[model samples]
Target: MPKEWFKRVYVCTKPFMFMVFLQTSYAVKNLVVKSALNKGLNHYIFAVYRNAIAALFFGPLAFFLERKVRPKMTISIFLKIMLLGLLEYVFGILYCYFKNGSEKKTLNTERIT
Candidate 1:
């Protein structure tokens, strides 16, 4: 009975543990980013480093997971990826406008022209 109980505990996936881990990671990331920005980290450099880190982690995973099924990498696909990355930066401008504009509108400080 003890052996069976141990096996059950070992095999059970502790989803709660994963949730705690994910939330803690998010908190730490937020704290680090806020502190760095408060210390005057350049936004451009921060964004580059963030994306580079993401790519370093995901690029290999993508290569391995999709290697057997994905289409061959070609110049067109490479160019398209570059374009998509560029388009992603447009969100930075959109974020600024929405955040700033909403604050001003809420305060009745400026009307959109």
Candidate 2:
């Protein structure tokens, strides 16, 4: 019985490790893309496109993996998550908008006419 348990654990290890590796890779790639955009992109389009692509890649995986455990679709949980998501989106947009707006204003003021 002990041997059988060990065997099952060993068999499950590879898939778990693979999932960790994939998640780490995705995080690193996202950080690199974000840094590149921050350095000189100066356009909301690039950020939006990157976010959309990431959502496209992860959304299906999340749905598939959580299909069995997904909480019974309920209004309260949905509202909670929606509110959190909206707060996050608003914070990010505000931060980026203010940062870029100030930079542009400074540059315009410094220009020789």
- Superposed on all Cα atoms, the candidates' RMSDs to the truth, in angstroms, are 6.8, 8.7
lDDT of 2 by residue, 27-87 (tens): 9988987788779875587878778998999999999999998779689999999999999
Q: Which residue pairs does candidate 1 place in steric collision? A: none
Clashes of 1: 0
Best by TM-score: 1
The prediction achieving the highest lDDT against the true structure is 1
lDDT of 1: 0.85
Predicted candidate 1 versus true structure: per-residue lDDT over 19-108, tens digit per residue: 889999999999999999999999899999999999999999998998899888899999999998988887765676588766354455
TM-score of 2: 0.40
Each model's total of backbone clashes: 0, 0
